[model samples]
Target: MKNVEIYIKSTCSFCVKAKNLLKQNNIKFKEIFVENSTANLSKMIKRSKKTTVPQIFINKVHIGGYEDLIIFLKKNI
Candidate 1:
């Protein structure tokens, strides 16, 4: 199993979808909510080099957002 980390916002539909996909695959993840804090948002930006909700990392590798995650799953699963 890989160590999965997801940066998400509470009300984002894509974030919900991403989490659901992971759940369906039985993949556990650490979720960092960046909806309210600038510090966390900045951290997510720095870590992912992206300004999007649902930035995902698996085993410290940046895997991008929901669409990218779906692509990764299709190729790797």
Candidate 2:
């Protein structure tokens, strides 16, 4: 199983969707909330090269946001 990490904001619909999909698939993940802290947001941008909610990583590989995650899951699963 791949180690998963997701950066999210609580109110983001895409973030909710991404988490739900992970749960449905039984994929355990670490959730990093970037809602309030500038430092956490900066970290996500530095890692993902994206300033979007639901930035995801699998085993330290950048898998992009929610749409990209779906594509990756489809291919891998």
Candidate 3:
């Protein structure tokens, strides 16, 4: 089983898309909702260097947002 983490915002459409993609792939993931929590958002930005919602990590390595995640999945899957 692969370790997957998704840093998401509740209002982000991209986040929804990303999550749907994961569901379609039958992937299990841990989701961190960064809503009204500066500390959590800060942590995600620090780790990913990205301010976008749906920042993804697989096996603890940052894979970026939705588009990047799709590309990574295409390459790996």
lDDT of each: 0.94, 0.93, 0.92
Worst 10 residues of 3 by lDDT: 1-10
Which rank order by lDDT, best down to worst?
1, 2, 3
* Candidate 1 lDDT tens digits, 1-77: 49999999999999999999999999999999998989999999999999989999999999999999999998989
TM-score of each candidate structure, all chains considered together: 0.94, 0.95, 0.94
Winning candidate number (lDDT): 1
Error of 1 at 23 (Å): 0.3
Instruction: Point out the worst 10-residue segment of candidate 1 by lDDT.
Output: 1-10
| Candidate 2, backbone clash total | 0
Misplaced by over 4 Å in model 1 are none
How far is 33's C-alpha from truth in model 3 (Å)?
0.9
Q: Write the per-residue lDDT of candidate 3 for residues 1-77, one digit (tens) a residue.
A: 39999999889999999999999999999999888889989999999998889899999999999999889889988
Specify the highest-TM-score model's number.
Answer: 2
TM-score preference between candidates 2 and 3, better one: 2
Q: Candidate 3, 45: how far from true, in Å?
A: 0.7
**Model 2 lDDT vs. the true structure?**
0.93
Q: Which stretches of candidate 3 lie over 4 Å from their true place?
A: none
